[model samples]
Target: MNRPTPAADRTDRSKRTTGPGPRGRTAGAAVLGRAAALGGLVTVLGLLPWLSGKDPALALLRARSAEQEPTPEALAAIRADLGLDAGPLGLLGDWAGGVLRGDLGTSWVSGAEVLPAVLSGLGASLTLMGAALAVALALAAVLAAPVCLRGRATAGTAAAVLASLPEFLLSLVLLIVAGVWLGLAPTSGWAGPAHLVLPALALGLPGGALLGRLVADALPAVLAERWAELWRGAGVGRARIVRAALRRALPSLLPQFGMVAVGLTGGAVAVETVFAVPGIGRTALGAAKAQDLPLLQGCVLALLALGLLAGGAAAAVRRGLLGPALREAALSLPAPLPHRGSPAVLLALAGLLAAVVTWGLLRDPYAVDLTARLAGPSAAHPLGADALGRDVLARLGHGAATTVGTAAAVTGLSWLTALALGFLPGTAAGLAEVANALPPVIVGMVVAAVTGPGTAAAALAVTLVSWPPLAAHAAALAQELRASRFLQAQRALGASPFWIATRHVLPAVAGPVARHAMLRLPGVALALASLGFLGLGAQPPSPEWGLLLDESADYVERAPVAALAPVVALGLLTVLAVRLSHTAVRLRPARPAPTSVHTEGKTPLATPAQ
Candidate 1:
């Protein structure tokens, strides 16, 4: 037989290890699972009218004419006309059948076909999202280039700061500075391409920063690989090597990219509301407020489809990027690089936030002075006055208590729930994968429908959706630890499952999960704010940050400071959270290596005989 080269031998080995048969089976099973999940979601949405406990006939009557009084005959006639007299099961079956036939039903409020309206809104949102994704990718490449090439620490810091800014606040700032002050772009509405510039930048900049940081953190390992070294030794150009490294790094980053895409879809709600863009998110909010279940259901289903498509696209790209050898091997990404720079900046931001909250608390936020309405900042009104002449400083202070306190509560509750469910990694991870597609805004709509819109409703909505990430993290870490060699050795020593989990697993999982949850606190606050901005959370006069932002929009030109005040507070809070989370991660105790088995230096338990 002819002697085979080493490369051929390696290729053959890789082919054997990859086993295309198993890969195809896994892919098919995944598709089936996703389809089943989608079907279940569709079923739940189809039955929503019944589950909401609100009479569609009564809601329709109110929508048509609030003056109309309900009578049994009129209700029956309305139900007959709308085909709602069908029992819940019948309605579900009919809806399911209609969906299969490409009919999304008609809107109760507008008397329009739900599918067309939903598609129009989805088209708008997709246009905006596409532009935003471009901006994000461009920004990530620019920011990460320096770090990847030169390992510049400053680039990472810049990315962190940029990433820390909340989407709503950034959008408003962009609207004011870029749209109002410089006249560089349209402030609101979606009449033309120019209208997209500000909102797209607003949405994409932070996401790009986040993505760039991930790329920067992961590229070092890729560049250090033996193939990269060999290429460099063979006189490969730096740019070409960097490009290859990026492609290598991309497979690991694809999942995060999917998350960022879904986040863009979810975040369109707040951005759309601010910019007056008629996207599906805004449409869904309107339908929710109107109790138009058909329209809302159509909007929700479209969003879900978009989310699933994003995830599938990411997976496809990842598979394309990885070679068979890499695909079959477990890729352990390096820990995130430690943030460089002084804690003083973080402390200074914390101090500023604290001062604002303290100064506001010292004054009465509810007190109104019509004479001071729209007044500029002064000694008495440090942050100026709102339209109602209430002290902006006082409101900001009090709002912190409401907004931040509720977010903290939601985070704590979510952490507990994640911990409780994390023992079942398979179930928790699967549920999280499905739930990840349901954004907080959508969840808020459902909760508002059931509980009515208020601060409590907003809190409940946020709590419902916030646990998935934490649970997913805990589950992933648990799975990783269970497969570790030390854990196998422990099992060989006759340790009970509970003992192994409690002694080895919980300690390894808790810190990271808690940090992850802490990192999400700002996002929870932002979600609550988004709900309030959409009028689904804290009503008028509550001074919730989101409500404050909403109230300040009209006066953005007259008193930009009023808007700037809340934006600054939110920005500071975000920066502080990011800094603290990073610090915590850096300070966390490292876990023992897989082969290490020193357990408090006690006499080792004897291994069971084979």
Candidate 2:
């Protein structure tokens, strides 16, 4: 090749100088793409009601006007009055203009500015989240010490038990025991710091169990690595080594903690309902049921912001834990546990089934209260009375019946959907991925628009939105398992694809899929309660925990125990379900041999080699 002239080299250098580095250009492009996607999502959310073919005029007239049957002329008049007759483009313009001015319009139900309502709810939610996080982290830190130092199984067991407890169920149990059993804390509306105690613990403990277990397991594993032995040989104190191990393991735990934080926030729907605590999550449930577009949009946006904040904090914490030297390594962690199963599911199912039978055979939940409007718990009315003077115990029994039946139905339907669709290939993956992208809240709203509010609508909503994630996961696992040698041998032997799938692939993945389905049940429980709280699930006097919560709020101070009975019952059921999921996951062997040594049992990294 001929050497380039000095003048040619100078021109080439100038051209290179003006171009950006690869990463810089890539990041800029990503930012722009995200902005465009967000804008599109906003437009879609703003027009969701119209997109669903729900008529705002009819909805408003039904909610606001006294006339049971309005004439066509009246309906048209109301539509114009609300300016809901605007075309899609026009509505978009109006909504965007209001958004720019920091206004979210008035709520159809409350007739108040959306900003104030959202802000009020935000304050309560922030308080709950802050308290819950503090409690969880503190408790976990303390519990972690024993596991890191002595490999205490008790600490891990505690975490497992608590993590399996449902957030709502925990709140309910605490409320009843504290307010009714011992007459300890105020269980009704938020008054002062006292009210925060039980809810905070309920919200925090489930997360604490997870954090403590991870921290405990991770620290021991870190200590067992080869490098740690060097420090041990150098006569480094065990305490210092423990601290070092913690610093390494902590970085890995923060991301999960962030998820726990979000769960605490979203899971607050149950806690807030039980305690009559006004929070954005509860407000979102309300807006969805009423089909209040502006209020629901505002709540969704606020929650999205909160989620982003949690994510940012987790990232920052991860970076801090990584430090400069370990920065590269910290970015990478374990991908996933390929297989996990638990046998506790059988125990949980049996226990819950027994409890359901007991509740049904014990009393009638629909018996009306004849004595007092809101009586305290006593022999006559063990759970007390509602505002309508209904027997709290009877309603609770009926609620247990309704709640159990609904949960079982939803779980079976959702599990079958996941199994059927996930077993397929091409079309199943694409469909699941699409469903995964849509928010569950939006799906609930859409379903409500079609079916109106009832147990059926809520059940459908939960089943539809919940199955996609599980299906996507199961399908992916199936795809991975199909590549194994045994499956391949069957395939090469001329076995039909369907036969191989059923006989081999299905059983191989069934353990993990079943556990996964169980894990999703607590979420389903929350969805049911949320829909009920929002007036879309169990109607009044139905005894569904969600409906019980809604109907009991006003009478909290009057008959705290009656108002809280459902919380206790629902919480126990939820705790059982969670335990079932965890137990199910634990039953599967991690290695080919059940007795194979695990990382937790391994000696510390600093220990001398044999």
Candidate 3:
């Protein structure tokens, strides 16, 4: 054989020397990011026992056990019997060892194996989730089809309105139309596919709106890509281009799918509560109420594990699907997005929130006259009274206040706290990612259990669950903005980190923070509702919407309309919240794509929206 050519030798040397270059580094960073996020989640969960304290769980254990002695020795014996005597390390070791052997322990309340019981509920939850996910995707397609078929201007009209409403309120609307007005399906109870339709529709709509938005956002850039230009220059048809655009846009949205899943799964608590579905949410609700840590932990762990898997799958898909052009655009200056959603819808939502807050403040929900028990709506009582003579309308109003106020508080706290938490460089994303992986209901339960069930506890729980996404989004955006020229100039000029963050990073993060806050409202509201239904929210005599619904479950026939009044109010708020979120999303200033990503001699193609 002849001596190796210079080019071939150079290529071999290059290959050998360039191992795990930029792309490899990126992949490794992604893996580490995932691990870090998962670690944060584990940290939050591992600290739950300490954070929540052992007393409540111990008391619950005591009540479950037949021994009636109140001595410290007896309690310690009970704790020992239940395996609570071990230190954290030992406990973790035992738990890990058991998990390795396929043993998830037994429920304190049910005395059944935790794994099998949770698995039984998992089947139902997954079925419902699957049905809901499918409907959401289909609805998204239906919403986006016209935008692709028509010009991109078609995005901000009816679709914006549809996308704005929260999932629970949508569920209520479907319930009324399908079950009451149209009489096509049962309003409550899980019978078969007919009963499933309304709840699935409710659970799916918000997600559909999210998916639609993602599609709309992704479409413009996708159509502007070099590949799309090549296809267009070759005289490709609109249908083929639309298909190709959708394919390209979808992968970018993979990370978002996990975020959407939080809303989807969390939203299910309300859906399950209202539709009376015997799914895992309902089961988890029962476990939470009873303060059965073993069962609750098992259920939450299984659900969280599933969520982690879903998140990982989406990340992998995103990694695999990101083409060189999109990757180049990744470092590109974020593009300035066109205003694409309805502002009027957002105004309507804001008005409704004001109404709820006002109505709740004016109403005296706890005033019990005892004369108008189980009364119907009339001039004397506009929304009627419950079995205990509390005004249903007043209770509904107060409940609305609690729901909306708590959500607002949660929203405010999330943003305020986000500024601080997001200030941590590099690690903020990991913390946010971990928080995103956790289920809202699980967080709510832990907070409530620790704080001992009250409106404040409920609010705090909701805040903890809802804040992570905002923090993550803000941190990610802050990081991106930090790489900007102005920030670099500020840094070079010797400006303080805080000054740069406040002046530049915070402002950049503000719009996204606002948009995310709105989207979180419906989910947060639903979370409050769920916690109330589970008896961990709004102490008795202090009405909340979910609490009102739960209290009147047995009185549905006595005052059907009154029982439904709170639900209708919740529905209204949920709808408004959804609308506001979508509308706020419209106002987001589009990030400009960095021009430096492209090589010399070729300009990027113009997009249709441009």
Number of backbone collisions per candidate: 0, 18, 18
Global lDDT for candidate 3? 0.64
Model 2 lDDT per residue over 247-362, tens place = 76677666566656555655666677667788887887778767777788788767766755765687688888777887645143332222233556656665765665475448
lDDT of 1 by residue, 1-610 (tens): 9988999999999988985573355445445545666677677788877777777787677667789889999889988776677888888988888888999987888767899999899999999999999998998888777766685534766676677565667788888888888999998898999999988998788778778877887887677778989998999998998888878778867877877777776778778877889999889888888888899888888887888798789878888888776775545555555667687887788788888898899999999999999999999899999999999999999998899899989989988888766665444545556656666777788778666789999998778667765665666577678888999999999999999989989888888878877766766776787788788999988989989988997897788787688877777766676676565444333542221111110000000000
Work out the TM-score per prediction: 0.84, 0.70, 0.78
Predicted structure with the largest lDDT when compared to the true one: 1
Model 2 shows how many backbone clashes? 18
How far out, in Å, is residue 289 in model 3? 0.6
Better of 1 and 2 by lDDT: 1
After superposition on all C-alphas, the RMSD of every candidate to the true structure, in Å, is 8.6, 9.3, 7.3
Cα-based lDDT for every prediction: 0.75, 0.64, 0.64
Better of 1 and 2 by TM-score: 1
The 10-residue segment with the lowest total lDDT in model 3 = 601-610
> If the candidates were sorted by their lDDT against the true structure, best first, what order would they fall in?
1, 2, 3
RMSD of 1: 8.6
